[model samples]
Target: MRIRKKIWNNDAEPIIAIMVVLMVLGTINVFSSSFVLGTTDYENPYHFLRRHVLVMLAGLVLFFAFRKINYRRWRPLQGPLMLAVIGATFLSLVGVLVIGTEVNGAKRWLFGAQPAELAKLVSLMLAASTLSARIKRGKANSLFNVCNMKYGLIVVMAVLIELEPDMGTAAIVLGVPVIMAVVAGMSFKYVLGLGGFLALLILILVNVQPYRMARLKVWFDPWADAQGMGYQTVQSLSTIGSGGFWGMGLGEGVSKYEYLPEAHTDFAFAIFSQEHGYMGAFLVFLLLALLVLFCVRIANRAPDEFGQMLATGIMVLIAGQAIANIMMVGGLLPVVGVPLPFISYGGSSLMVSMVAMGMLLNICDHGRNAGGEFPKGEAKVTKSKDNKVHLKLVK
Candidate 1:
């Protein structure tokens, strides 16, 4: 078995195909979803369509860049990750307070030196990389050890994200790494036990906040608060149901004509369904499903644990967020302001999604180029100082 020295190793077909389809669908959906608002708010009709094109182009470049990079050297990145995640997330939160731009009562940046949207991918990478190294270092007591430095950093990232009060992104930032943890040799018992505790904390967090609690209530019966908290849900469901099977046709939907707020952002899925109908919605689901399947295949083919875990983390981020957004529109869950993955009209979110995909492509390449199983000594299991089983990092 030969270990290759260069990158660009994986077949780029899966990553490329998934991204191309997403960009096409997202472009179509964004134009249709944003039309009414864009025209009424701006003089030119193609305002958002043009912007989406630019963002997509930039994201494509970044994705291809990730495809070319190596995934194995992240081990030395351990110490700097904490500082990086903290500095970046805080700067975004603070920028929204200081010189940062505000969009909808919440502080997030659009055009600036720092992009908060990028934090999703950045924080996940930092979290994933940190744990992969430690697990390799023989920390697999895997239970109590989960509470130490590995999870500690993740908790800090979650805290900062919660402070941003952007619960949607915070959920994802935490959730993706948790998936990676499970893949990186976490115990089923502890994972399930911790999952239960986290769910309880989420319930308490949602109820403790008056708005979150209100949203939950409205989710159950939006008609009850149609004039207040339930207004969005009521309108969303109406739009969704109004579409029925075949939809009203592109740019012909009544809801986007000022009936539904946020027709392009949080509620974009509703608009997409209203225009494309159940068929369109199903196609969206199919596209997303294919994306995940190929990504999983890539993960399975990964050359190393770092590559596999990183790919898994990206898949979870995209698929999880997409489901959250779509379910919110379906009235199956409370509205959480999560953007539909590739289809949302925001640059930061779209660009970051592609970048994460790019990282996965890199991992795939590493896997393909990697060529063989563990070198003789590499597979030997070792016990840590505390008698926990752990694997050694590939040199």
Candidate 2:
């Protein structure tokens, strides 16, 4: 008997390494960006730093816990998970509207955490479970039914998050699932139709909110309102521009002192760019892009449909948020309050993202254990009369 050489190494190593680097760097960035805010707001320079450390600890706990659980287990508990996630999300959104803390005109927090952040993970799970189940059952061929089955819960969650006026997260919660559905074999016709509808809805939502419209205006002309509505954008651009090709130096950027609002949260990328330069920012982007690529590889080798969709959904969740944060900070897109994955200082976002990464790692482990081929079989590539290649699984 001959043994086959391994064609790929373990996928978890690079991912875990990237994650650790980001967390350490994120801690440093948070300290630098939030020092002034911490001192002025709470009279303690370490206020945000301490909270960030605690959050990082919490996220690590979740990451390790989820890593031990098998990705396939999520299949059997999909129904219950959906119900619990929806119930929690609905209650949280309602609670925010009624009594949750309102900061900067948005009521997006409850019990000291952002429920909308958790909503992104839960909605992704539900979407993955639904789409994968349909694909396995041969129901994915019907666009209408697939949309109804997979999208109902996602639409509900998106609407609630949008109402929270956290449009950044809402777009992610909605967008990730759509990407998963498309990957799971939803027809392009239905995708375009729904895409158009969602775009129009977003337009309406933007037009109705004065702040959102103001953001749009700033996107087009940041200098026009440099001192008012465009202050954040102009400040962010100036910080990056000041950094040149390489950043000023770690902990040396002055924009975080008072110029850029939300420097530690929505605009952390700008702070990072200022301190580390465009080269550092590019490295971060490269890391995230590699993360997504590894995720796609895992999805291809997932032991089952559930694992495939789950991995894909996780990739979308992280990559989508990363792109949004980078684009907004670079002034290529309007500011949308999206945090950079693994590098932003929000407890809920960090925790949820870590949990999602844990699941992705689990899938990678499972795929490796399955010999890097799903369904516990060998795949033979064959060409048909039409000259198209076909994959046949052999026992």
Which model scores highest in lDDT?
2
Cα lDDT tens digits, model 2, 243-271, are: 88988999899998888999998888899
Please identify model 1 stretches exceeding 4 Å from their true place.
Answer: 1-11, 73-90, 110-115, 134-141, 369-395
- Model 2 score (lDDT): 0.82
* Error at 214, model 2, angstroms: 2.5
Q: Which candidate leads in TM-score?
A: 2
lDDT measured at residue 266 in model 2 versus the true structure, 0 to 100: 86
* Candidate 1 local lDDT, 210-277, one digit each (tens): 88888877788899989999988889999999988999898778898889888887898898889889
The CA lDDT at 335 in model 1 is 79
Candidate 1 lDDT score relative to the true structure: 0.73
Query: Which runs of model 2 end up more than 4 angstroms from their true locations?
Result: 1-9, 76-82, 369-395
